[model samples]
Target chain A: MKLELGKLTIRDIRFSEESKISEGILYVSKEDLRRVALTEEKIKSADFDIARPGESVRITPVKDVVEPRVKTEGPGGIFPGFIAGVDTVGSGKTLALKGMAVVTTGPIVNFQEGVIDMSGPGADYTPFSKLLNLCVICEPVDNCEKHQYESALRMAGLKIASFVAGLGKDIAPEETETFETPDLLTGMKAFPELPRVAYVQMLQSQGLLHDTYVYGVDAKKILPTVLYPTESMDGAILSGNCVSACDKNPTYIHENNPIVEDLFKQHGKTINFVAHVITNENVFLADKERSSNQTAKLCKMLGLDAVIISEEGFGNPDTDLIMNCKKIEAEGIKTVIVTDEYAGRDGKSQSLADADKAADALVTAGNANQLVRLPKLDKVIGTMDYISKIAGSSDKALQSDGSIEVEIQVITGATSEVGFHTLSAR
Target chain B: MKELTILTNNPSLKESLTQKYPYLRCGIEYRDVNFLKLLELVRDEVHKGARILTHPLDGSVKPMETPYKSILVEKSDPGLDLNSLDLIENAIMSCRKFHFDERELQPRVIKDFQIIDRTLMESAIDTSGLY
Candidate 1:
């Protein structure tokens, strides 16, 4: 499959009477976006705000961040499962509004939400701080359940993002790039001499607030399956998981996955980028064993020489990572696993909950327990009431001077296991 | 399906499981213990030949971050399942790695933890087909 991605560089975002992209600036009608968000009855109120790069703004208790994208000339639309019909996507032309994101925030549904500082020491840790963010703050109706609120907020963000991205459908793009992945037989025939490689993406599917969806199906219910590399670019997989902010793959990261992009760069040149394998991190031991067994079997069936496995979240998922690594290596296939560490504040603890000698080739995305101090900003887009209770934060997180001290885990994308951010250790 | 028992420290989880699966009310065990003690209870059950159906450290909320945890296990008295032993032992070891401070959390936040724990256990039960 081949996909042509057209990029519309958004230099500025402002509230205007109409929503459109002109002269590299995105003019959004706040009322229109709010209307889109309020379509869910579970959401009692919806408000819009903007935070730009170098602004003294902070967004806290963030649920998800999504880049605006639309299919210009494709078989299906972006976000195949949720925003669009359950059609197979990943071919033809798609337009993406670059340099901006739609960030969702609300009352803390769970403690696994995150924070994004637009301009401060904390801003440097999260990539979302650099983007022109259109913040969607939604409030749940009275007596709304937590799961109901999460679902409403999640759909609201995706709907608003899709609504904003529709403006770029007819506009010309500033840049265009094409990505193509051949079928297994064709790839092997064309690049028989190059090393055959594939990527194993582990989706977080614990339950409730922690889940990922592929084509609208809960990932935990699905077995190990193969996807066209280009399909993910067109939004086949999306994050509904509210794990730790540091390592969770928000929808934005899924739309712009660094691992997929980097592997594409080395495709046809150094390796025969064979396929993309997706498996889930379930809570049941039997499910874990079944999924990992199927994953290794799929890798062996694909005749892959090497595989790059990326984990989402941590703890019990670490067991799945090790199981995949050990089983795949047992098949004589070289495997490289990517993960982050929770080595404690002193950096003296075990990095993972589970470890194996076969996981020798590993890439660490820093430690989530590394402490940092975030100075108070001039304006706050989301409530700070939950800051001290978020993951990696403590009771004494908020300082008397209005600043906050916390582990980098409180910052979104700080230690992404997929190499989304620039943090790495020697 | 085999006889499955759910061990949880969260009161909300125990109530929900019993309410949802009324027939399995006899198997749901609710203990008034902290997160670590709940895992110790599961470990003790594992030593008595109970197989861990779900992972002890299931959620990504960290070991000590959330005060509630629910684990599902097969109630069969088969010989010791080494996999269950290793998993529970590792979970206990992982729990000790983190520093647990008794901070007063908001009532709403505590309720949120209970709901999350219940949801995770429900997922395991859904897949386990204990009904």
Candidate 2:
């Protein structure tokens, strides 16, 4: 018998065997073949471990497998690019993107309306330091209580002093307690007249804008911070523990601040990302069953790497949030969870899982550079309509392979009209 | 009654209670891991009015026990596995948060693990009580 082996394509190979042996072809004589068979029998006496990248199979007669001369693409070419989405928990997109899971929010009222609010004096506008490299970004500072803030800032040499200290006035109640730390002085100074424009400009001057990944843009404008200020309450409202007042418009906060527009104008080219407003509810399912289903579904939607529970544990909204985060983090994805709270130390209302989930979501969302919005819909039909909206009324929904596909689940009627128009338009 | 103590891997949450709630007197014991056993121990303790604690790096134990005291309402911990540890960790983290005492809670780092580096352990340390 004749045996042959050779490379077929990039990272691929083929082996073939034939009954007739040819001269000058690394062939063995009949006697030699019998001797080889005897040698194989003898080799069975010894034990050895073998490893191979691709599958290996044994053939009794050593039949020939034709070596087809075909072009092939390596793993590098076929691998999927980053995929992300922001949808309501029960929407079932989570199940679609399981492998590339980046950031997932809880339930939301309006994901497209979501925004990032960093302006005014109380914005805590600190330059991006190298120490914050490992720290995940969180919103609203409510998640980061005084203790958690102090700990996070401890290495950075910043501390949480008094919340009411720097508001341009001596708002510190006459009986307000004070901390004996440098943070009090620094915070007081930074707060009174925060140069929001100068601060972001200076940071941008340092090439921070270029360093960060910004995602999303419409044909007309970039949507870096989808300003859903309704969920973006003022820090003062957040400070008062009045959860109901947390919703504010991001555009209002941005438009009101001359500094924000100035920074945007300067770095808008570099920070060409779009924003979508989403509610805190989108990320946090109302119940455990919904949370798990949403998580599992989202994982499927995104194609996440691995889903592991947080060191803090599992179940509940926090656990659901963290597990979703871990799935993204394992892939080294950047996410950002836009919210009005920090990762508090006390595992009281929200668990570390919850906080970390927000952090991971923010970091990954930031990295993916995709704007997702989760809005609450009063009507079930509205959900389908929203999906249709995202799918595009003028264009077909593009698939992972860039092929046009139609989803007829709830948007069957909408897709029909779009499909007819698309075909006729084509 | 026999003086029973709850052992957890989370020394930070354990230490917070000692400083925050003066009325509650108990020691939070730290163990390397039996993880499941830790949950059983926490449940055993919370039932007997014992304090429980947790850390992000302490690994999973059980869910947190809810509403231990009026101050410690809305505590939640869902252990990695469906066990008691998740309950206890959530309970402790929650208690440490909403529970208001005249004095602020102070959390201290108790270095018990030799394998875990300082940074990993430090992150796990919830120093919220100190603030």
Q: DockQ numbers for every candidate?
A: 0.76, 0.04
- Can you write out model 2's per-residue Cα lDDT over A46-152, one digit (the tens) per residue? 11111112112110000000111110211111001101122111110000100000011111111111111112110111111000011111111333332233222
Weakest 10 consecutive residues, lDDT, candidate 1 chain A?
Answer: A417-426
Tens digit of lDDT per residue, candidate 1, span B1-131? 45667888888876677788876533778899999999999999888889988889956788868989888888776788898899999999889888655799899899888888888887877776765
RMSD of each: 1.4, 27.1
Given candidate 1, what's the lDDT at residue B124? 77
Segments of candidate 2 deviating more than 4 angstroms: A1-268, A277-279, A282-324, A327-332, A337-426, B1-80, B97-99, B102-131
Q: What is the lDDT of every predicted structure here?
A: 0.90, 0.21
Measured against the true chain A, the candidates' chain A TM-scores are: 0.99, 0.19
Candidate 2 C-alpha error for residue A56, in Å = 82
Q: After superposition, how far is residue A315 of candidate 1 from its true place, in Å?
A: 0.9
Number of the predicted model whose TM-score against the real structure is largest: 1
**Local accuracy of candidate 1 as per-residue lDDT tens digits, A73-162:** 968888888889988898999999999999999865657789999998998899898899999999999998887888999999999999
Best by DockQ: 1
